[model samples]
Target: MSQNHTWLEIRELAEALYCSVKSVYIYRDKNLFKAGTHYYSVGEGKLRGKHIYNLELCRKALLERTAKDSRSNETYDNKEINKLMTRKLDNKNLSYRK
Candidate 1:
């Protein structure tokens, strides 16, 4: 909600993201970005009832989510993979009867 942030309509947001308007709506529906926090609805006679996106807020939220996902899915080294595989094999062998 900084003064420098540009407010965009759904179409404009989709255009900025290189996506369809429906996709933007979908993101809104999925709560990937929050309303009021990331955007707000204008209740003017001219605008009727269309939400406006605070560009910086939306971009920041998306980037933070992306960074969190990347950290959670951190790449494993060969040794770590080998150790996980060994554990899985051992568990599988233990389940079998002689």
Candidate 2:
């Protein structure tokens, strides 16, 4: 919402953001820096103007961001079910038929 004191350097930014600088670096490295700002490289690996953070973006990122990702690896044999069901009926049709 209000982020008058939102613009901050690395440590301050991390503190205000309630996250670690390392996490910030991790996000930055992963290109997951969803803080709604374009990074303008300061120089020699330093960055500036990264404090364009806002509550909306932070909330969205926090809500959407996952701490640990679960890779979808479940391989199911749907061909059999598809063969039996075909496109003839939906779940409701099957249930109603019962």
Candidate 3:
């Protein structure tokens, strides 16, 4: 295995996820990110917390989560709704589906 980077921190994960530090914790609370899947702690449950994550994987997870959110049965504002509609119309495959 490769040597772990000591400088890689949670902030990097936050940036990779395009989310705030608080949101990362919130996602953690919601079990949005699986421990071993997206995150790895150098020292599990220690005073000095150290976690090494695969940034690429974290980004992929975040994107997938956002996609799920966008497709959810939830209300959206006019701006967002219009944008989604426009995107759907512009997407050739979706446009030709019907």
Candidate 4:
């Protein structure tokens, strides 16, 4: 861990990020942040434990995720438009045959 990075508890992280605690947990559960990089479990056994998060890592992960999602959305939109254009051309061809 870099000395400049801040590690924070769930509540503190939420406060710092201006989000709810549940949102932070959602990010963890969804695997948006990798263990040992963005966060670490602090407890014994398999029962349950507190998670300390690297604030900088979490922010970076979120930014990457957002960029990836934006690219995927653009690709999806392009595919949909192509499908619609293909359908229209097919309809036109059928009309000419009639």
TM-scores of all models?
0.65, 0.41, 0.55, 0.67
Clashing pairs counted in every model: 0, 0, 0, 0
TM-score of 2: 0.41
After superposing candidate 3 on the true structure, give the runs of residues whose Cα lies further than 4 Å from its correct spot: 1-7, 44-48, 73-98
Kindly report the root-mean-square deviation of model 1 from the true structure over all alpha carbons: 6.2
Give me the overall lDDT of model 4.
Answer: 0.86
Deviating ranges (above 4 Å) for candidate 2: 1-5, 34-39, 43-59, 67-98
RMSD of each: 6.2, 11.5, 12.4, 6.8
Deviation in Å, model 1, residue 80 alpha carbon: 4.2
**What C-alpha lDDT values do all the predictions have?**
0.81, 0.55, 0.70, 0.86
Candidate ordering by TM-score (highest first): 4, 1, 3, 2
Candidate 4 structure quality by residue, lDDT tens digits, 4-54: 989999999989878899999899989997788899999888666889999
Q: lDDT tens string, model 2, 4-23?
A: 53444567656766888887
The candidate 2 region of ten consecutive residues with least summed lDDT is: 34-43
User: Model 3: how far is 84 from its true place, Å?
Assistant: 19
Name the candidate that leads on TM-score: 4
Worst 10 residues of 3 by lDDT: 88-97
Point out where model 1 deviates above 4 Å: 44-48, 80-98
Clashing pairs in 1: none
- Which model is ahead, 1 or 4, in terms of lDDT? 4
